[model samples]
Target chain A: MKGNEAIAEAAINAGCLYYFGYPITPQTEISEYMAKRMPKVGGLCLQAESEIAAVNMLLGASASGTRAMTSSSSPGISLKSEGISYLVGSDLPAVVVNVQRGGPGLGGIQPSQADYYQATKAYGHGDMHLIVLAPSTVQEMATLTGEAFDLADIYRTPVIILADGAIGQMMEPVDFSERKPRELPEKTWATCGHRGARKHNIVNSLLMEPEELERSIRDRFERYRKIEENEVMCEKYMTDDADIVVVAFGIAARIAKTAAQIARSRGVKAGVLRPITLWPFPNKEISALADTAKAFLSVELSMGQMVTDVKLACECRRPVDFFGRTGGVIPAPADVAEKLCAMSRELSI
Target chain B: MVGSSKRIIIVAGHFGTGKTNVSVSLALASASRGSVIIDLDTVNPYFRAADSVPELRAAGVRTIIPEYSNTNVDIPTLPPEIASVFFSDETAIFDVGGDDGAAALGVYERDISRVGYEMLYVINMYRLLIADPEDAVAVMREIEGYSRLRFTGIVNNSNLGAETTRETVAASVSYAECVSKLTGLPVVFTSVIGDARAPEGVENVFVMDDHTKKLF
Candidate 1:
């Protein structure tokens, strides 16, 4: 399955009955797939006039106690950011997929991880953070999409499936049968009307009093603290007693993994630590590796956005390096392997 | 290998049906006789034949792609150089986009008809929506309608990537046969990845190297 279509199917399987999106390259297949499959499953797939409207529609659906989602590429994602902040402020549960393309603004339609800062630090405005899940393969694209919905409902916040254009366009064998049912909580806070048996449920993000808004924001941060403790997901490959640890995520990790294998074959002690959850940032794992690993390399598709987070996680215990190919250019395995070999020689490890 | 008699070959199918792989393989196989592969996939911004230009050039196959391909610009404009393939003696193979992407082919309908071309509808039984024979035929007609061209044959390029085995290829034979029967088109070939042999009853086996897998 193509990564974009896999996400749409997995979203549908996760009981997402409403899809509102606008078309953008690299990720348009998600909308096209939903348009074809949604009606057959008694779901609604609407093509909104713009990304802003689509995201607002998602907010409305989520507020009404429905599993809903919207997807876009980098530029379109920029257009949807305001509505995303609204979704978060209202404390609504929804899934937003950004099959990331290169961009500061309408940058390109090729695979890129440049949106790392946008997704994790400043998706919209104000003090906020989105639970970002990055999938390195098409299979993870499916599994993570289904998991995104559950996380949204459990945490009562918006979840972002942050994928690059490479995975969105690639084809691979995916097994959907392995997904086990998740125990999800009910939407008691939903404003789906009361039949005189209960008080009216209101959903709003606007709190007039300064203290009231501060309390609400702090309360949400408390939930975020719990998430940070329990939901940090990372995959370590051959990290035991390694001198150089390559920290990456999404498609960059896949390329880095192969490069690490090549380095290992050539007698360099290199391994990869892929953060499946980008928001939590896998700090504990990297911090622990800092004890034994002499140095770290952060590889990305952008100009070292995540490298800052990597440095912070390691606490300067080890020297950290950055390697990247920005503006829609993908580095070949040989190129990354060359970087790893050079780093090893410089450190004499 | 594609017969030398066919001067122009166009590969079209629904999305993710391995159309670009089939086109690349066919062009590489025919490269010894002076071949050119045109990347006419304007709809998809990623994983197009343009991505394989380095390997294709290494194999001595000339490639003509959209001007802004692999760049930040997402314009779908076709290059003027594409029209030259019609007058050239080199065997021209077109890797067209999937489904409505075939609409880009309509621009050269007259030139293609005048030069005479063989359009192959690539099919993968493992792909969703078009998994059934009837659904596959529907997509085939849709492509034909959009491109203003008709398919001369069917290329059974079915396989589950990475996990595909001899058994997996063998399982798709009956499905491909059903699609061939529905469309009344001959099964031109069955593409098998790497060193796999043709499934028991399948003929005209095309051994394809998985070029797209190296992209990641």
Candidate 2:
């Protein structure tokens, strides 16, 4: 299946019973898949009028304590930002799949990672970060999508599956053999018809009072801190005893992995650090690698969105060079390898 | 030389049916003497057949693409060189574009019908519009009407991309049978990714690799 369709199937397998989405390129297959399969599976799949409506529908479903999701490309995601913020503020658990395309606005529907900042640092208007998972392959698109639901429910927050157009459009073998345990905590705070025994579970974002909102912000940050401690996921290849490391995520990491292999064959000690979870950003792991590696190369499909995160992760302790192809252009493996070679030569490693 | 006698093979279908991948594989598979791949697709600029020009060129397959393909600019300018696919003696494969893209092949329609050609309609029963067998037949008919060429056969390339299993391939067999019955055309072969086993009694199968996948 296409990466987009695989995500929908994985969502179904993960017990996500509700899907509300609008049509957008690259990620349209996800909504299309849901529209076809959800009804047969006894689930509700709705093609909302707009991206905002779709995200708001997801928020409503989440408030009702149902596993729900919404997917869109870059521009459409931007339209859902207000709803996402409201959902997060109301402490709703939902999954938002952003099959990223080129953009600052209305950008072309080709693969791009420019939304890294939007996905990780600022998904909405507030001092909040989404639990962002970037899938490098179609299999991961399934696995991470399933995992995103579990993480969202566990953290009681919106989790974002930050996949680019390449991973969402490309095909590879995927097995949904691994399933997240469904023994999740009951939604005690869910607004789903609270009986006469208890007060109505008000799912609202308005804390009006300054002190109250401050305390709520602290509580949310505390949860984020706990998630940071427990849920930072990443993959490291040939990083041990390597002089140079490549920091990437999603499709960029796939190419970087190939570049690392080619560099190793040519006797360049290169490694790759692919951050599976983009929000936690694998700060400590890359920081630890900085102790041994002489230099780092941040390769991305955008103009160095994640490189800033990489530098911050490593605390600026090492020389970090940026290699990127923007406006939906994917960097070739050979080109990435050549850039790494040039970096190695510059550092005399 | 799978279809050696047929000079031109027009691979057409709805979008994302692995037509480009099939075209590339066909060119590579039938390149015993030499093969020419003409990229007549202008609908989707992202995953066009021309993107594999370097790979096909390396494998001794000549690819004739439009003037501005695989570039940031998506202009549907057809160069005169496209006629070479018809003129040359080399076995030619035409990766026809999807939906409205079939109209792009209308220029060569009269020539192609006159010279004789095999038009294969690739169908992925999993895709949105073509999920129903009736819808699949309708899509093929729509393309045939737009391209002014009749479909000689149906290529059951139903897949769920990477999540495709032997079951996924087999499930499409019944769908393909229905489509074949409706269209009065034979199911030429079922295209499976990698070595996923073909359905029972469907001996003719096309094993497709993920050559069109941009990354691993």
Candidate 3:
């Protein structure tokens, strides 16, 4: 299954019923794939008029305590901001996908990972926390999509699947399993139409009072703190004797894996630090590795967004070098290997 | 895949591939008049059908996308409006960015599943990694990691040039067959551009035009 199509099927298996979305580049297959299958499996699939409508539709469905999701790339996710804010403010469980691309705007069609900050900080307004999952391969797509929904329901917060075009466009072996649907805690506030047993519930982000909003913010952060404790994810490869280390996530991490292999072949004791979860970044893991590794290198699709975090993880124990390919250009494994080797030699590690 | 209440639809694949094009074709094909196309290709600057939002609007097909269609734009976290549209007569298409789509949209399934909906996974074997079943599975897992949604079906959108002959269709048919064997999700349809006839063995044929809304 393709990544997007796989997500649709995974959602269905995960017990999703209704799907709403608007089409855009890089992510059209998600809707296209759903259009064909949802009806057959007794599910509802609709293409909303706009991203706003799709996201708002998610709000409606989630407000009623249904598992719903919307997906898009960098720019499309931008349009979904207000809706996401409402989801966050209202504490609704939903999923958003960002198959990142290059540049600030309409940069290029090729895959680039420049949306790190957007997914983590600038997605929507106000102080809201989201669970972001970064996958390095198609297998992770299936497992993480399923996990994201489970976490969303358990935590009552939005979960994000952070991937790049290469991962979505790329293919690998995957198997779909019927996951045990999460037993969501009753949302006493969901707007299920105020019928017989249901009370009229409102889901919105319009907290006018500073104190009230502040309290909500504090609560949200408290939830975030628990999430950080419970859900920080990463993949560490051969760092025990590593003199030079590479920190990357998603597709970049995959490339780093290959780079580590090649770097070792060239006699450089290089390793990789792959973060599966972009949010609640696995700083603890990196900081622990800093104790053993000589230095760290950050590779990304951008100049240095996640690198800042990697540096923070090192905490000046060792210098953190940076390397990347921007403007929709993918970083080759060989390039990463070469860069790591050169960096190791330069640092005389 | 557990007992989830919401069914989700995810659109993901490589760039320069036809996930977007096929998404539009699939939405238009399965949709019965009043369907909407939600464009989420905020990653790519050009080549998004949202450029002509008025066209889909005039055609009675509504659209929802990111705040802007620029490259440097931020990817927003929005709601999946399934409840209102699910029971309504309108059909919807969510056009997500290729790889970017998998990450962001993967989280909302728990919410939508509670409402009752099925999800679809679309594939274009012509794209990288997805050309093989193993690669396809890998991509699937990555998407699963985020959306928390289970995929129920597959849509084959494979073609070479504008003149996608039977060969292109046949190759994809074989690919979809293998994927079906691996993932247990049937390929429901094969999409074509213009009046390109449906490939002989395909279940459904989705036709799209140049002016039709494209995601990537």
Model 2, chain B: what is the TM-score? 0.94
Highest-DockQ candidate: 1
Question: Candidate 2, which segments miss by more than 4 Å at Cα?
Answer: A194-197, B4-8, B13-17, B25-44, B54-69, B72-117, B123-151, B156-184, B189-216
Per-residue lDDT of A1-349 in model 1, one digit per residue for the tens? 8999899999999999999999988899999999989999999999999999999999999999999999999999999999999999999999999998888877888889999999999988867888999999999999999989999999999999999999998888887876776788888999887888788888898999999999999999999999899889999998996889999999999999899989888888899999999997899999999999999999999999999999999999899999999988898877888899999999898
- Candidate 2 lDDT over A195-268, as tens digits, reads 68798888999999999998988999999999999999999999997888999999999999999988888778
- Report the error of model 1 at residue B68, Å: 2.6
Q: Write the per-residue lDDT of candidate 1 for residues B110-159, one digit (tens) a residue.
A: 99999999999999999997999999999999999999999999998888
Candidate 3 CAPRI grade: incorrect
TM-score order of candidates, top first: 1, 2, 3
Interface RMSD of 2: 3.7
- Clashing residue pairs, backbone N/CA/C < 3 A, model 1: none
**Superposition error at B25 for model 2 (Å):** 4.5
Candidate 1 docking DockQ: 0.74
* Lowest lDDT 10-residue stretch of candidate 3 chain B: B1-10
Clashing pairs in 2: A1-B160, A1-B161, A1-B162, A172-B162
Consecutive 10-residue window with the lowest summed lDDT within model 2 chain A: A174-183
Better of 1 and 3 by lDDT: 1
TM for every model, in the order presented, reads: 0.96, 0.82, 0.64
Q: Which candidate is the best by lDDT?
A: 1
